[model samples]
Target chain A: MFKKKHPLQSKSEILLRNIVVTAMIVFFLVFLIIPIGIAFVGSFHEWNPLSGTYRFLGMENYKEVFTSSLFGRSMINTLIFSVVVIIFRVGLGLGIAYAIYSPFIKYKSFFRAIYYMPIVTPMVAVAFVWKFMYNPQIGTINHLLGLNINWLMNPKTALLAVMIMTIWKDFGYAVVMYCAGLYSLPSDALEAAKVDGANGRQVFLHIILPLLKPMTLFVVITSIISYVQAYVQILIMTEGGPGTSTYLASYIIYDEAFVKYNFGYASALSFVLFVITAVFTWCSFRVSGSEE
Target chain B: MKKKIMLIAMVSALSITSLAGCSSESNKKEQTKIDVPTEVFGDTIKYDPNVEVNNGEKVTIELWEWGSDELFESLIAGYTAIHPNVTIKLVNNPWEDYWTKLPLALDGENGPALFNIHNSYHENLINYLAPLDIPIEDLQADFTGVDAHIIDGKVYYIDYGMMTGTVYYNKDMWEAAGLTEADIPKTWDEMREVAKKLTIKNGDQIVQAGLNFNGDFHQNYLLGLNYQLGENIFKEDGTTPNVNSDTMKQIMQMLVDFYEVDGVGSKDFGEKGADSFGQGQSAMVIQWGHFYNTLNTTWSDINFGVFEIPTFDGNPYAYNRYNGESTFGINKNAPKDQQAVAQDFVKYYLANDNVQVAFNLAMSTFPAKKSLANNEEILKNPSLRVLAEHIDRYIWPGPMPETVENSLKRAGEEVFYNGVDIDTAFDEAQATIEKDMKNSSFVSVENLYKYAK
Candidate 1:
């Protein structure tokens, strides 16, 4: 049933396709596959690149990572940060997208631009601005609120402060994604719901939400992965301070690899984080009923 | 079909060639001759000032430092003027990023030929450093802190300066609080009293802290207090940390009381002590001598005065512990020609008296060069003069591991932020340090404080 091509034309097209496919394979192998392979192998050894030392100690690095209290604390902190950020970022993002997509709403593009600004801004710059704003003495947050709370210095509030800043910086991304999803939504279902005298809340709850599930799933899974790997804000704002209150699993990986020069242990920790993220992603997909 | 096969073969060849290029670069490094002098322990290689490095070949030596780009620029220009065949490129990273990047950079082929070393991370970096060929007797006679950096007969780098904690107070705030030159406190009790008088509060909030020690407990306060108590934070072996000792608990409690009891400072008063003092929100702060330069550049308008760190009692073993501001270490992994030029630059840096004076003044540190101890530029700085007066009262704690500082800082945070008991906090800090030290190559310099008496 397919159309046949001339021999010479087919040969040229196949040659171009082969070259493109080969180039992509080479790029991935060099950049991604090889690094992952090295990390996997290095995870079993005691490696210090600076000192040129490497010793094989099967699973010892993993054992230490599991036994360390700081590692456990970091895991819990990262989980809490990810869960909280996902909920707020996705929820606020959907609400803002829906509000902007409403027929009565004016200046929809302007609102979209305003909300999408933070996503494009550098995380380091955003983190520094938030660090200053959370300062108790001279920060705008405390000054405007007339409160004396130490947002980032107190152990109880440090992680929460970081999570809030993360949400603010990232919710914009979800907003932009959801806005695109909203634009592509079929108008027939919405018109029918209105024609049937359905209220705004009912339409949103029953029809809009279920239709937007795929977008929501994409946002949630990506958010989970991104939030689990969140460390730049922690590095800049707190350095996991106030007695490790803001220590995330990724931050621990950074500290082990860079600060402590324990590359092997860091590799082990990275693999553990990778497995956790995969599990989290699997669960997200399964719960969303999109596994098939 | 033949075209497809040919494409696959070409792609495989490209990948193999790219990897081969990487392997060949490493092979080149392996084949390169190490031109450094080989001397046995207790032997020294005489340094020649007129030695022709790189045989007058035009070479560029990359020098990496945390900060002080302008100072290095001037020094580099001076060196290049004297030796027209050599060029020096300065790569400056922020202080926090430098430690993390330096090791990774040194591990690779394209690392800098010369890089500044900090004693805190010296042990981790020792294997990558090329030992200096300077004579031991000349180093001992000319530099005060050369003994600490010399291992066997090899000198990685001499300490260019000595820095310790000092009490920096705003002169305007001091006078406003009716304080005079005689009001400068010599003991902790008197200092606390002065701090109380200088503190200004609005209800429960401290608008102006008399003395702030919030985030600087580890760097500026704890070590000094430990010294004043005649205690070392590390055991004699240095590998085993003793941060949970009775003396440490005493000092930790005193630190807590400074905030919780005296109310002269607040845990959340400002982000850091130095920043608070610089912003005119604090009357006094205990900072190292380098803070003098920081304030001079960052907050030049503040009229500040320097005094010796107050002691617990009138006389103690020493008032504080000091660490060295080390000279640059030559990268052994650098190209042979670059290493030769780096070595020559080190010689030029040490022999030039003007460069020595400029470096010490710029760092706001006491000169490691004995001749520069009385140099006009060195003595002109008020903070350096204060540091010089009590320099003997400070003991050189040999190359402290970063773990010690980090653990102590965490301990302070636990006590201040989490309300953890001082004993538990310190015990945790000790455990952390001990565990970290097991993986470290750090060893204490014996009898570092033997002359404190």
Candidate 2:
């Protein structure tokens, strides 16, 4: 440090490092970036996989995507699903994480494991299990509540039912993230607030909450991304059914691409969703306004 | 260092030698050229059970079917026993997953040699299917619903069986309701009354549904009802949505009334409508031939009977909308030898009496071959016999888009589950189906009519 000296590496060693880094960059570009780029390009072309044909359609596919009623409905449903999922995931996650990370709590690891079990379980299996539980007749929920409401069948409840399953399956990640954030929180600031005639709530709101901003951003962005991309749970639980009550944007894209073989339009729809997600991510970063 | 290099060489040499041994073992098992015979089965299919194949070739033909694997396993084993060179593999994907995976699977080089698809998706798959080796005239001579497999004047698929929708009622429930076979419903109005009578309720809850009217097969029933009323839901060109009509509205109204007005069924039944019927919690279900197998296996003690779905009040006949079952086709892109072997297996599979009887018994779907219908094993079951008798009566609903049926099903779901008005549901369904049809890749409705003919 006194001499401002630079350590030198062997030519081969530097070459090896360069090679590894280049390989990683190449891999990312090939596997991730290229496919996404192809999808963007193909959004303007009609892709007929069977005939092995792709005819350029200019902005027609994009226009169709914008005009499609199903696309609009799916977007609305996805927004609702994502917002509801975020509320549950963030609210419950923070509360549980705060409680578990508190000094008064015991068996912290056991509680964390219990909450994290759903996250580890396969979504399909979780979806099916929840679907059975939501069954109107012999379902656990109906039997316990002593009401014969068709949870998955009723349009009013189908999306909410699927959202509950999604939240249950995903909230554990938030809980764990929040717990880590709480553990690493600046205790000195919290103590200062407490000592300055602040109560627990004030200590939490004024000191802990502000300090946890980075973790909240992380959880919120990731949760929003995951929820926006949800398809399998809806596919399994309600099949995006009861007259498309639970149809999400991702589900509609899948239906278009796979079910209807409308790949070009589906690609356009995907790009739209991609743009929405990118915008949300950007907005999130801007609003958070804090970074290490 | 010398010792380490020597050890590496020894290991490499051993690995190569082991690999060579395995390869040689695979190649040197046995080989023989066997001639295929020109013997014909039933004057329709050119199939001989003992027809020689390339002996010891070890060709594994994968068949993707949606039904139970019991009969398929037995048939494949039998085929393997007869022609030891061929190994028939049954890849049984459930119905929904099968349809979703098939189109993608066919895009690859390693797709199944043969696969079954629903008649609904036949249009979507025609380009990918290999035409059956048999002559179209010969196939039509033997197989019922052969027209359903035709595309561009070539038969590319064949049915192992066919199922026409019919009213399957619990005889015990009917008797409990103080009714008999002679008193069976003959008109839509009569059917509703019978359904109401057969249903049993206990304090605002249904103990037994009269007619388990739910979303399952709702479109098929509605289509048949529409037919009875002399209305085709789709235009002559199959993709043009013609569901916005008076006759269609009447049909939807009847369906809606079954849940709301008549209370013969409920949303509580959901997808388990058939299950309720099987368990005797429902008196009746308008189901295809497969209900015979489900009920026989699940509720063997419950007495049951089958009747044609009742006609509209003024219609002279019941409209039986049937779907092809066990519908199979060979992959067009398969290797020539594999495709030939697959064709041989298909012929062997279809021609074999044991396979036919066993498949029918397991699936409760009627044999596609008319010759198999009169088999004592089939005729003994009155329900199956009734279903089989009307095999010729199975109506082909031109090449209708699956979305049309799905949209109709959703309309029923809206009425049944969401308590939406019948007219409102129909209007929504008509709009959705029209948009779907417009955006659809399917040919015009006129082509469907020509194809159906």
Candidate 3:
């Protein structure tokens, strides 16, 4: 008993849909884009949060950031942190995923849940637990190893200690993604390769690795972005101490903005960090595309 | 379609009823008031019985403290009962977060009515605090260390309590290391020898540190040492940092010796100094009187004793840096009525010796007033008794306390971690301090209190 809509009325309905879509776009531009733009502009100014005062100085904040030794050290530390975390997270994640997915393995669902537990655990709780484990005096890690190395205090080991906790906390995402990727791959292609006398490793290396590119790209990109901006663990565990050995860019920015009240300088530092993350993301996609 | 509409109507009715239920629940909020013995309670606090309650008018006062809420819980309840119209909201964040959020809150004109700040941070917050509503003379007359927090001759802060820094030693560890009370070091040189003696090593690993040299408290700890040696790291004007001075060089060298040469404590050990001492891994640690209660409660098995930080020359001077304790300031931006009420609460809080006694007992810190120094509660605690005798020597680090503290830390780290020579470390620290000092929006005044100097 419903009347058929006229073609003119359908066009009007599409126009109404376009208006709603435009409104949503405008909302996003206001809420998201404006704040980011403000931060960008504020980076070129000196802002005192306490006094509610600001003064614009073009390129000065950037210059100071570049010249500051703390900034330079933190940049290098950030790079090391990101690179090491990405490598370990992806490599271990893929290996574990493959092992669990293999026919030889048992208790697959249980193992999957176990691997995903760390991801569900709060980072703050994880950091605190890991801090206790890394404690030089009574930490479980040292107690078990029968060694007296200061895991979180020694400059040589502090960053590595933090990275280890981070990888353990985050790799479950990679596992889940890889597991899904493995499930979606054309099963006959893998079967065909196996029947052609391709051994297990050969089957993995030749067929699976190439086919899991999209999942790898997703995991790598997300992990890189996450690790590059990573600092909460550092803040809780070490607080960027022992002569700034574990100081990362994000931590320095946080300390400057919050602790030191150098909002302008912090903004500039954050913007630089943003650019670095963007370039790394682009490079990741480029490398993936080149491989394809 | 009618069935679907009927189902939607039922769901909507249910949602409305649930929301109404929530509103009713919220409206039924109960304020639990404790029944106190009028005879004892009325004697402790003086309240005007005739003051009319501002009935039907709500006045909410927000309070922020970097401490336990329990200390204020009873007081808030008591105050609220008296002034039923006034609602006191208390937010207690840890020290670090308090400082970070405070500035932003004040800038936004939404700061607490009454908040506590340390003397170290008072300079940075000078402009943001409301002047005391009461007469400045009255406040000074009642509170000790009132001068420490005064800026530009205005009384903006009052210490709710005070405690002085001192070195805490593990008695059991000393005895285990074949030492006794007679071997307590009186000078830095003697302390080094004692530390070396007390240190227990299993191969290359230090199982028991002789003296814990933590980086976190390097500034507060070294300030005492600097004071003992008559060193002012900041000039009289509080503008330039005396970073590369002879005294600083000596101090840096001493720290380096502790880490690299004497091997008394490792950089790692310092990070976990409190824990190390707690677990009997460190023989000696430096902390304030608060640690007395901390040690007793947490590590009661370990026998610990307190002593003044050993001086360079073994002088009789028992000086150490003390901070403004329980120091509360009124938010300059708080509403007039709230600020007035907050000040009234401050006065009421300070006048009640029983409240002070309870706070000190709970926190194990000394009360702010001199009269409470000999209170029975303090006399009962052995550590508090010993600390009481030395409270006179508790000094304020000259000006720009945090800056000086941070510079000392950086200098120590440079010597200890980076292997920078003492002179170079001090030099670099001096340069950084000077640069930072210049960059600050407001400069600290000339040396305010000569407590140690």
**Span of ten consecutive residues with least summed lDDT in model 3 chain A:** A45-54
lDDT score, residue B278, model 3? Answer: 81
User: Please, what are the lDDT tens digits per residue for candidate 2 over residues A2-49?
Assistant: 976435457787788889999999999999999898988988998756
User: How good is the docking of model 1, by CAPRI class?
Assistant: medium
Error of 2 at A273 (Å): 1.0
Task: List model 3 lDDT by residue over B43-82, tens digit each.
Answer: 2224352353344378888888886554465566656665
Error of 2 at B107 (Å): 3.3
Provide all candidates' interface root-mean-square deviations: 1.5, 2.5, 2.4
Clashes of each: 0, 4, 0
CA deviation > 4 Å runs, candidate 1: A1-9, B1-57, B94-97, B108-110, B450-453
Clashing pairs in 1: none
Return the TM-score for each candidate structure: 0.90, 0.87, 0.85
Over B205-245, each residue of candidate 1 has an lDDT whose tens digit, in order, gives 89899999888898887766888888776677666777889
TM-score for chain B of all predictions:
0.86, 0.81, 0.81
Error of 3 at B205 (Å): 3.7
What's model 1's lDDT at B214?
81
